[model samples]
Structures are given as structure tokens and as C-alpha cells.
Target: MNRLVPLAVVLGLTTASCSGGHGAGSFLPSGAPGAGSAAPASAGARTTRSTAVAAPPAGWATTATQAVSLKSATDLGALDATKPVTVRLGLQLHNVDQLKSAVQSRAVLSPGQIQSAYAPTASEVAQVTNYLQSQGLTSIAAEPNGLMVSATGSAAQIAKAFDTTLHAFTVNGVSAYANTAPAYVPTALNGIVVAVLGLNNVQAFATSPHRGGQAVNHASPADSAPAPQPESPCALSSVFIVGLPSPQPIPTPEAYTTGCPRNYTPSDYWRAYDVGSTSGAGRTPIAIMAEGNVSSSIADFRVNEQGDGLPEVPVVVKQVGVASPDTAGADEWTLDMTASTGMARRVSTIYLYATTSMTDSDIALMYNRWVTDDLAPIGNSSFGGCEAFPYLDGSMLVDDEIMLMGAAQGQTMFASTGDTGSFCSVGNPNGVPGGAPLVEYPAASPYVVAVGGTTLWSQYDGTYAGESAWNAGGGGLSQFEYSPFWQSGIQPVGTTATGQSFRGTPDIAMDGDLQTGMIVYIASAGGWTTIGGTSLSSPLAAGVWARMLQNHPGLGFAAPQLYHTFAMSNPGTKLLGPPPTINVGPFHDVVSGSNGAFAATPGYDYTTGLGSLDVAALNAVIGQ
Candidate 1:
């Protein structure tokens, strides 16, 4: 059973033409905001600008206007003119070239260093703030990094200020508001203010959480008996298998039978992934990008830790915007906390960056906090939206900038690739099975480690048995984002419509099949429940990453090193001649199964990416 819930927001921005190139060398196109020419002195050092540019007058002139489209939604009418709205103005970066170069070199800079060298200048911030104030908008504040400026006003005020119209609409029977026309900026803040977010309130991201059914005993076919009751912490010996006939649909759980698979616990993951004798040990701190009140989740974590006989990890909640009392995402947040901490066993701290809502604007703030705070070296985002929406609205570019800064600061975030196989879902809440081929954003962004799903089979003792790509796992070529430098030579199943190679997901895989779901404690649910999805896979990856960071504290971004390690282990020369007798690598390369359009292969494939990790082996060679 799939439970679709609001998790994050999606905001829109004006799209710009990008230059065609390979690797990090091709910078943002000239038309793109924040495109700079200066190069930093060193990866860790600050760059020196030749001269500052003067700000333009606060006159109302046409800047780039964001094209808006209400795909498949019914237009109701104009939104309430007096309705209050909050919008975020994305500012241009100071040294875009330098920031890209620093990230490419794997420079480990601090938050302060990143701000000093690459953040928007005071003049740029002032330009945007001045423009907003001139338009009669209030509560104008700029982020410390100067990447975004927030303002509040009524729908009329916002529409007038950005030269657009706000109209009400019903999307999948849900009320929503969007700009009827393109949203533009004043002439003064043309390139300086890249994107205007929050002009429309659209449900952008959907949480991927699939609940498991009662344990079935498939051992006896002739013996007709009642299904087994749900176990609090499922036994390790009750292994589940996929590909069997199910009473429900593809994503839903199959009918209960005898001796079927059960949910997995923290200890089960530790043993299955070969994470022996390694805890974060208070060295690595991680963050969870979440929404609403997670107080119950914290309580649930403590309950899980005590029940599992594990050490308690400190959790600090940081309210990004206003404190939201909404607990709609209780299962998702709780699963993130429990699954992540459960995998690492222990960590220095668990920071929850809870936002007011799951809107694109609010979620952007949550991500910005995680990057600018620089407290957590690793973070987990178990939510995402279709890549096309963000790309069209410009949040993709906005979030990508934040992630670039994160990469330069040696921070790694893991995001779920979604749960609807190779295509995006159009259904409300839990994604339906069909739509055009598109990957999930944040995950599609080259900066994050896009985690996919797998159906894991373990031994009776919970030791590693084998894995295959989960049928419903989200993985495919990106519609907008280009492939990063590390993925240069990799040949996935297909190419972009233009016959070019774009970014493909996921970067890695983990257990996400409902039949092999993790045993989680949801306070609101009143007890333990088995849940799966890319949501489960992402936090699990983050926890494993925390353990790796604990062992090697100096490791920077993980993708480059991960690809390099895989390439070293499997040489083309050897693969071309014959299949290697022995497989040698930090990852357990999954060579079976498919996620709709793509299938897993010998090396890197679209379905499973670089496959699942061998924690011990990965930790040993990640830093080297």
C-alpha cells in the first residue's frame, strides 16, 4: 500500500538557454544569472574581483519573465486579490566560475569561506531588496549567503510587483494558485535577481512511503490458514521475495501467505550491509530535510532506539520558517530519523530542519539552512518532485546553486529518486504508475547522490544474500540537468531526445521493496509498521554515508570518489575480454532486474546506478 503525502514544495522560475558542453568546464550560459569570469586563487582560497559593478535604477522595466503553465489543472478564476503571499527572489552568485571550479576540485571550504568567496555581494542584495520595497512589499530579508531574498504581500501586490496575474485552479481535486502569465523583475534587478519563487502555491514534492502487509507463509500452499499478525520488530529469518503473484497492484503488497518475508530491523541492515563494529561515534553529524512538527518523530526515535538496544543519538530541531503543527508527514519524517540513525547505530547529532510547509519556497529555505548552517557533513532528503516542474520554474537552478556550495563545503546530501519507476506520476499523493519519462529533482541534480531502490534478499542469519533493482524504483535520464564530470564516459541505456547524454539516476541503490521493507515505529500509527519506497532507500544511504564519514573524516563529495573506485575495480580491458571470475569493489554491483524502461547491467546501469555499497569496503577506500 502506497501512502502519498505532501513532503516538499515546488516553486517556478524563468528558464534560460544553457550552453552545450561536457563536464564542469562548461559554465552557465551568459544569459544565465550569476555567470562570472573570475577564478579563485586556490580551491580553498577566496577570489579577488577586479571592480564592483554599479546597481541599476529601481525603474519598472521588463527583465526575464518566468513562463508559467497549468498542466492538466482546471482554471477556477483569479485568486483573491487580498490573499497574502510570500515570495523568494533568487539572487545571482558572485563568483560562479570559482564556485564550480572549487567543487570540481573537491575543495573543502567552510561556510564562512564559501560566503566570502562566492556569495552574492551586498550591492546585489540591496538591489533586490530595494526593488521589492519600491513595489510596496514588506518583510524583505536576504539570506546570509545572499542567494535568496524573501518578501511578503497580498496576491494583488505580488502580481503587480512581478507583472503577473495569480489565478486559482484545481489540480487533481486540490486547490492551487499559479501565475497566469510570465513573472518578471524590474530592469534594475535583471540578471541580479534570477528567479522569483512563491508566485504560485503548487504541491511540488510527494513523499515515497509504501507500507508492508502481514507476513505471509508461502512455505505451505495446500494448508489454508490465517495470515500471521504484524511483528513489532520482524524476525531476521522471515525473508521475503518479490515477483510473486499479488492480490493488489504492482506497488501494493501481495496477499498474505505462509512463511513469506517479514520487515527488517536496524540490526538486520547492519549485518546485511556488512557494517560491522562501526558507529558514527560522535564524529559525523547528519541532517534531515523535513516538514511539519517532528516532535512525535523524535519520541518515536527514542522508542525505536530503546526497543532495538541501541545508543541514543542527540536530535536538534531547527525550525526554518514558522513552526508548522502539521503532522501529515509523520511516517516519512519518523522513517528518516529511525532508518538513518538505525543504520549508523550512533552519530554525533541528528539535525532536523523542519519547514512550515511542503511548498517549493519553504523546502528551498530548508535546504538553504542545511547548506549555510554547515553543521552537518551529511544530510538526507527523502522527498522530491518531477524534475521538469522545478526546471521550468527555476527552483532546479536555485537549489543547484545551494548544492554547489554544499559540495564545496564538503557536505553530501542523499535524495530519493522517487517511487514511480522510470516515469513521473500524475496521480495525487502517492504517485500513480504513469506519466512521461522523468526523474525526480533534487535527486536529478548532479550535486546530490541520487539513491534508488532494490529488492534485497538476506540469509537466515540476516547476512547479505543478494539484491536486484526494484521494479518500481525511480531511475532514468534527466530532462534538464546535464551529466556531471564523474559520469563522463558511462553509457546508460538511452540518451536524451537530442541524442546527448544527460544526467541519469540513481547514484546508488538500497532495499526499498515493500516485501523487504524496514520495520519502523510511527507514533501516530500507534505501533510498528513496515514501510518501503525510495524514501526508505535514501535515509538508509545517508546513514551508511554517515558511517563512512565517521571512518574517514576528510572525504569531500562522494560521487567522484565512488565512480573512481568502481572504475578501478572493473577495468574495460578485462570486461571486454571476458566476465571477470571474481567481482572486486566497494559496491555489490547488482546485475539483475529492471525499473520499467531501464535494466541493470554488468557495470553502471540506469536502474541501480553503481549498485549498493559494501560499507566496510567503501569506508576503507573512500578517502584514499
Candidate 2:
């Protein structure tokens, strides 16, 4: 799941390549796009039919035909003067085969090569390093594939290190190119090493069954199925949802961004939330945190239909981030913090003020406002800070405060599991003595239900068609102190030491793979891009919980009670026991996928935890 797709998946495009103009209208919101819903299928067909399967070339995923402009780097003085940042430049190797045969017979680093044991050697590493040395850049890390190089002298001096060119043609039969001789260099100390994943297999789709509610067969295929189990009834819990703005079309020249699916046609998301046939919706004042200008996205969703023939949840927008006039870095993330409509609704905007610029106090201030002023029972956070544990600590503090505030007013706080699995190297403070693996922060926090990821494949006929752990799913045992409370029904099946290990993530899951993912249209970015990640799942669940609370107005804050009611209780109890329905239960145990070393098994796997929700069952249990 930590693997990053190489540029190859981007249609052979690279930072250097560019495609001839395609009609902007060709792009539509994600999900089964018009007649061309199978565009990905066609593109994949082209790959298998055309390219030779003899191991893909190094930088195999590099897709673009042109170099990404370093002008932004130049204007921002990306490169530092004096003490140049030592960065492990992520690049696609132009000639991996030649380099591999020249070096290791296998070319790629043997499995035992890297620390986490996954990275392969990039052909560009050796060649680029050699070229850099010729220009006076020195090596720091002496890894096999690429060296961690330090730029000597000024930004301009470092910029001169990048001097080369590359070329390629587009999938649409157009030519494109990239300039190696970058005019500017990056100045930030953080140098991102971008790894291109599988080039030709990128996919995005929508999986809502017939609008007729025919109980669409939701079974995992043979190749990707969970161990066989008895059938259970539908867990019709309360459904909640938030709406986002409709996406504006991305113009040409920069139309590639349109590859992303935009918002669902008016009804997609809300309908999905209504799985449980419960009514009355509860007293939980579901809150949405947003930064700025999402009025259009929300309005579009409101007009959309829920499956049962209703508009998306009714929402009231309010400002909560930095003052509207302020545009500082903190102000940006503040917007996400303040924007509170989506988690319970499944749609909302990521406030710009939510970035690292805002202080914990600033975040706390925003939280207080949403609980007190905005009248939300639970605040859904779909974002997180850098891999630093301190950030998690601050978030935990805010969460605790929000919970307390919500308790006084009867609300709960929810946050998304961070998306930084590669940075697992970051240690956690509350972890075991032997230095446990540090899971994502805020999610790892005791107060939060650390969400995880999964890959969903539609069951065609009677068998599974395609399924794989979502390449981007995150999961793992907590390096931080195990919050035993979060570990209720989760028990080890394999090795007691392993299964019963630290508290893992993803209390629940929903559709999140970019392919089969929900659609989101962003007018700000002005394009349609398919979006996925637990960021999407957590909010969807939050919206459901909000609705459940709304329907059961007397069900005081459910955070602490959810664990007691459903977690580790007797099998007879709705939590561990058999769900009321004997046909299909609310939860679909994820017996597949893995986050890192952890695999999805019988009961709980890092990939999907307690499977997905039994909304109906959830409502029944909570309402009891």
C-alpha cells in the first residue's frame, strides 16, 4: 500500500512530457462516465496489445512527455544557498535494464535492500548522481540505486545540476517532451522522492447497484474472497451525508487534472448513505469543517437525489477558519478545520488553513467555534499534520476538548487516519518498549477511530472479477501506547503475539479505491478527479453516525458508548454476536488486503478492521 505509482500510469506522461489538447468536455465527474465508462479498459487493452512484457523499462511508470516547469521552484527560491538540502531525488530511470545488468544481475535491489524492504533501484539514480558529481554535487547516502546527494553552493548553482532532456509520445498519439535542464531548483529542505507505480493499470469507477434496490450481490470474488462465512442481514443503520460543490471543467493545456472524477451527479453520495432504512435521523448535530468557497459544491449536492428519492442532507454553512480576509499559510488549513459539513454527509471541502501553518491553539479555536457556534454534535476531520507525533498529540488535545465540548452539548469528534504510510519511520511516544511501528498520528490517537483502506471489486455474475488491496490503503499496529479501549472485539488469530498485537487502525471502511471510488468535482482546481483515501471513508461513516444520532435524539453522545455496545460484547450482543439479519450483515469482514506486514484476515486486518458497516444493525443496536 505504501507503493507510489510510477509515471507510467499517468499515460507515459512525466514531469517533462505534455499532451496535445483534448476536449475539456471529454472529462466528466468520476463514476461510470458516459459511453466511455470503459475508457480505462480500452487504454489498458492498448498497453497489453502494444508494449512488450519483457520487464518494463526503468522509470517504467514515467508517463508525461515533458518536464514539469521548475518556474514555481524558481519564484519560491526552492533551492537553498550555502547549506543545500541533501535530498534523495525521486526519478524514473531511463535505462533500467542496461543499468540493472551492468550492476546487479537482477537490476532491481534485492528484497533485503532497503530498510522497510520495498524500494527498487531507479536507473535515474546512478546516471543522475554521476551527472551531478560531474557538476560538483556530492553524495550523502550510498544506497545502491541512487545516492542521497547534497547540493553545494547557491540555489543557482544547484539549479545548474539538473541539465538534460527526455521525450515521449502521448497515449492519444500526440508527442510530448521534458527538459532535464531545469531553469530553477527547489529550496525547501523536504525533497520528495516520487516513485511511479504501475503505469498502464490505473482505474476509476462507480459501483452503486440498480436504482431499484435489488440487493445488489456484494460478494468478494474467488480469487479475492474472504474465508467463507454464513450470510447475515442488511445492517440498516441511519445514513448521514454532506455535499460538496460541483466541479468546473478543467481547461485544455492543463486538462490532465480532469482525469480526476468530479462530484457525483446530484444523488450518488446521499443515496449511498441511506443504506439503513431507519428514519427520524437523531439529535447528533453532525458538523462539517470547511475553509472557503464550497457553496457551489454543497448546493449541487443538495439538489442531488438520495436513492430513496430525497435530496442530500440539508446543511447550513458557517465560517470557522482564519478570518476571511487573511490568506496566510495557517489560514489555508484553518479553512478545512472550519468547514464542517461533509463527514456526516460524505462531502465537504478541505479548508486551506488546515496546513502546518496553523497552531494547535488556532485549530482548537476553530473546534470550539464549530461545537459552540455551529451547533454540530460531531466534527469530522479528514486531514492531518506531518508525521510528527507532536502533531498527533496536539490533535488529541483538540479532540479531547471537542469531545468534552460535544459531551456538554452531546457531540463527538472524528478524524481521518493520516495518509502517510511511507513515513512510518516516525516513532510514536506511547508505543511499546521495543520501539513499535508508529502508525499514522491523529488516527493512532486513542480518542479517534483510526480509519483504514480497502479495494472493492464488483461481483460480475457469480465470481469476483478484479480485486487487490488498494495501492494507497494504510494500516499497521500502533507504535504509540496501545489504547486497549480501541481494541475491543479485535483479537489475534494467527500468532497471539501478532494478532493480539498493538491497536490497529480503520474502525470501519467504505468505497475508497480511486477506481470504484466516489466522484468529487472541484471548481477551485476546475476539473474532475476521482478521489479516494480513508479521508473519504471516515466522513461517510461520520455522516451516518450523525444521522443515527439525529434519528435517536435521546441517544446521548455515542462515542464512548459505541465501543461498549458493539465492541467485544458477547456474540449475542449486536457488536460481537450475530447481526439481527441472517442474510447479509452490515459488516463485510475484509479477509483480504494489508497495510504493511499486516494482512486482512478472518476477524480484523489492518486493511479494513471490522469490515464495513452494517448500517441497519448499527441503528438497531444504538437505538436500543
Report lDDT per candidate. 0.69, 0.35
lDDT of candidate 1 vs native?
0.69
Cα lDDT tens digits for candidate 2, 478-589: 5422333335345452223323334456565554554444433332323222345555556666666665765565454443445444453333222221111111234555
Estimate, for each residue in 497-591, the C-alpha lDDT of model 1 and write its tens digit: 44446788999899898777886666555456568998899999989988888887768877776777887775222221011111347787777
Best by TM-score: 1
Per-model TM-score on C-alpha atoms: 0.82, 0.46
Candidate 1 Cα misplacement greater than 4 A, ranges: 1-65, 214-262, 427-436, 493-500, 571-584
* Maximum-lDDT candidate: 1
